[model samples]
Target: WRRKNENNNDDPDPIPCIALALALLYYFRLPTNEDNVQRNDRSTPSREEFGDVLSKYIPGFVEIIQNELEQFVNTDHFVIPHG
Candidate 1:
């Protein structure tokens, strides 16, 4: 994707990119607080709620991330052999 856009030198539409990036980040359990002072605001959606909202735009996103995580954990990079 980067290489395809590199020569054109045109900035891509930021709104969708940012939205998708946020969705992906949220999927990975990362906090994306818009307001630090009101970070604990009750109106804010819970993690599951946030995921639900993202799911509307990104189908099967949660499952994909979870599967990737499982794969990582099962990989040798994440596993340690005790002597």
Candidate 2:
């Protein structure tokens, strides 16, 4: 499904859509102050805790990144045209 972007009148890109989906997942996982209050665990998640949670959700994320990197390297001429 594609939605028109209000700013450019173009269909939304998949990259940003994926990023937004991941952001939503992280936002829910990392609870807010109100959520902490309800759970009665005031201490926030540590760096390791955050990494563990992210790793759980995105097991294939690293593979995806590696594949993209490989594709980029295989390209003969990697260049972005200036607008």
Candidate 3:
């Protein structure tokens, strides 16, 4: 993929996008409130709010993401081949 991108003068890679997505998911899963104080700043949306926004853009986003993750984990991509 890198070679192809380099040959075409395209951007380096899409790994950052995947990393950002995973980071966002992890952030949302954290509790919004801790010890009666907001865990995040006012600008940051809560998990429910983020989910609502995602659902508006992609209907059934949660289910779709969950299904895709499950599929990936069960596929050979997640496996380390024996030597």
Candidate 4:
């Protein structure tokens, strides 16, 4: 099936990377005495949360995802943006 084409075998993927990064950033982003809401109930992040991560922790990471999605719209990679 599709399993044969993968680059790495039995490897952890982006889930843990993104999750741990967010958790660490979240822990540091809290106010000195404030508590974060329980994360168990919030499986999916809100758009604002994604924007917050992009703005505070990792900029252009989101834009990288955007370009990935845009690839589906235009497969011709040679297109010039300004021309």
Candidate 5:
């Protein structure tokens, strides 16, 4: 089964999509401006907003990340030692 993007674009390989999601996650975690960001000045409410966003999306995305990690380990591409 295949899922279509909201704009009706079909992507058979979703790996890039997941990679972009991870990049977005990092972008959101970054301070408002540290040279990479267009917006400058980190404020209290901006930090709060970032937290709110993480709380909203992290749970769902975490599962997706976990599945990818499992695939890596199963394929021997990842060798994470047990603690």
Candidate 6:
């Protein structure tokens, strides 16, 4: 999910987010821009087309992130010191 900061600006600029996402797709060796080729025989997938591809992996990604957060919270590093 793309998030906006308090001021309504993209917290992490969209370009890098898109680049990293594409890189992950490539790194995982999944069907990258080929998804578009299958759908429309295009070299580049439209945002919606690429999004459809990424959506499939979102659940697993979110679970990994959630688990990381859970583990982090359970560790002593999460403690806040008070006077």
Candidate that scores best on TM-score: 1
Question: Each candidate's TM vs. the true structure?
Answer: 0.44, 0.34, 0.39, 0.28, 0.32, 0.26
Question: How much does candidate 1 score in TM-score?
Answer: 0.44
lDDT, candidate 5, 1-83, per-residue tens:
23345455764556435544763566345553343344555453343344456546554444444554465556377556777
lDDT of 1 at 49: 64
Off by over 4 Å in 5: 1-16, 19-59, 78-83
Tens digits of per-residue lDDT for model 4, 36-70: 23444344445445556665555555454454446
Rank order by lDDT, top first? 1, 2, 3, 6, 5, 4
Mind sharing the TM-score for model 5? 0.32
- Of the two candidates 4 and 6, the one with more favorable TM-score, higher being better, is 4
- Model 5, residue 35: displacement in angstroms? 26
Give the Cα lDDT of each candidate: 0.54, 0.53, 0.52, 0.47, 0.49, 0.50
User: What is the total number of backbone clashes in candidate 5?
Assistant: 0
Q: Indicate the TM-score of model 3.
A: 0.39
Q: Superposing all C-alpha atoms, what RMSD in Å does each candidate have to the true structure?
A: 9.4, 12.5, 9.1, 12.5, 9.3, 13.9
Worst 10 residues of 6 by lDDT: 59-68
- Point out where model 1 deviates above 4 Å: 1-24, 28-44, 80-83
The alpha-carbon root-mean-square deviation between model 5 and the true structure, to one decimal in Å, is: 9.3
Local error of candidate 5 at residue 14 (angstroms): 2.6
Clash count, one per candidate = 0, 0, 0, 0, 0, 0
Worst 10 residues of 4 by lDDT: 27-36
Candidates by TM-score, descending order: 1, 3, 2, 5, 4, 6
Q: Which has the greatest lDDT?
A: 1
